[model samples]
Target chain A: MKKTLYPVLSVITILAFGFLVMYMLYGSGETPIFIIMAIFAIILGAAILALVWPRFSGTSTVTPGQSPFLVSRGVYFLMVIVLLVSFLLEGFNSSSPWSFLYPSENPFVPILSIAIIVGLYLVLYLRKSVREKYSFVELWTMKANDEREQHIIDDAARKTYGFMRMLVVIMGLGFFAFQLLGMSFPAFSVGYILFLFIFVAHAYFMFLLRKITD
Target chain B: MEKTANRLRELRKVRGQTQEEMAKDLGVTRQTVISIEKGEYIPSTTLALKIARLLKKPVEDIFWLE
Candidate 1:
């Protein structure tokens, strides 16, 4: 029952993803709906793949302290820097750096550019070297392979949750303070706040995990 | 409360088992074995039993309240 269910789920996820991509590229209107659907599909696909691939590939264990990707720490840091710079540029110019490529004022262009960049990263991530070094499940979910890894993950998660909770409270107070001062919050600041929050959370989590493991 | 401690490293060494071998036998990562030996982490009862079984010792003989 489990074996058959996995394959069926995999097929359904793949077909849904394919259809979503086709619709996104060719379909018109309902951009928000498509965006939400895309996010949902990607998440569901990742979860299913994480659970199923490990059992099939026989790579049940991962080195405790190793990164899930073939990319070096330098590369990861470089990507983060690039993302930060792009966001800053977009905020200043009121348009993405990739706007010139599409040459349109459509709001979805930036979103499309982000999707393209993510897709490219996914392609590189699935290259032969990475596939050989790490299982698909490990790469996709960053799931712990053993008790030590689980401990590290839990430790990192606990710390990150605490940090994020504090951050959210501060952000809420700041927003309230601005409103009380009769000041309007800049729309772009919202994006910046979200970006920084996510970036810091991830960096903090990784730092904690590395420190614990080391 | 008394802190828990263990003679994991010593017992595993006496059994002529490397950390890697012990981890494999216990179905865990080597780091877990190392952490247990270092007293940085405590194993759950099930894992403690497994470790005792692997080392051919009683759980109480391997672990103690200190």
Candidate 2:
């Protein structure tokens, strides 16, 4: 089941990448609206397929002492680093006046990003041991995060939420203080700070729950 | 720490059950089962009851407040 679905999903994602490249190269703002919408729809559909397909067709090869949560978290960590580094390098090098992270017209960056993502998925599917490990991980991850886990998570989340709220208040006050002092701060700095906060907070809570629970 | 000590380890060993086996029977992770045995985590009434049922012991025999 998973063996077939993975390849098909990878193909669709690559196809979406092809469409996006062609759209960027050949299509203009005056290009037909339907074409742009179709391109977007293809990309969105492929994204959803990547996440949902395995849930339906996945088979498990769970072995004792192997943890699904650990494997999946490792995968997620790798994917995030790959994605963040790729996009951040692209953004930092961009000459766009609007924002550093503004979507670059350079097709290579987007294509590279797609290639890496597809490569990861394909690599997971092609290797027998890795594939079985991933399947077991997925199975365990699903079962491990049950209602009881959610209750534990919710309690932890409430504390994290309060911390986030306090952070927002401090940032808000700082912004006002800057305004009053006639000092300037880049809007992107605030966005970056918020992004960092969210990412760190989530990772912290996940670690805490995984440690104290299973 | 206010530990809720239990004889789960002894009972499980006597029953010839590994933590992994008990975890599967109780629909939880091996780590969770380990935590319960180590007194690092206290299971809810329902889970304690389920564990008792699986072990074929009274709840009091498996767990008690310390």
Pick the TM-score winner. Answer: 1
Candidate 2 CAPRI category: acceptable
lDDT of 2 by residue, A1-214 (tens): 6568544644443354334333332323434543665575466445544543443235434333333333234323433453355345644554421133333456465455446655554543445533332353452253333334444444444454345445555665665576689885543344334435445544444434544334
Question: How much does each candidate deviate from the true structure in C-alpha RMSD?
Answer: 12.1, 13.2
Model 2: per-residue lDDT, tens digit, B1-66? 555889999999998999999888898767678878888778878889999999888999999877
| Candidate 2, superposed: residue stretches over 4 Å from native | A1-143, A146-148, A186-188, A209-214
TM-score of chain A of 1: 0.39
lDDT of 2 at A69: 39
lDDT per model, in order? 0.56, 0.52
Tell me the interface RMSD of model 1, in angstroms.
1.9
- Chain B TM-score for candidate 1: 0.94
How much is the lDDT of residue A143 in candidate 1?
Answer: 48
Give the best candidate by DockQ. Answer: 1
Query: Per-candidate DockQ versus the true complex?
Result: 0.36, 0.25
Q: Over the stretch A49-145, how does candidate 1's per-residue lDDT look in tens digits? A: 5543543244434344443322112222432453465464553353433222232446465456556555555564455544454464553256455
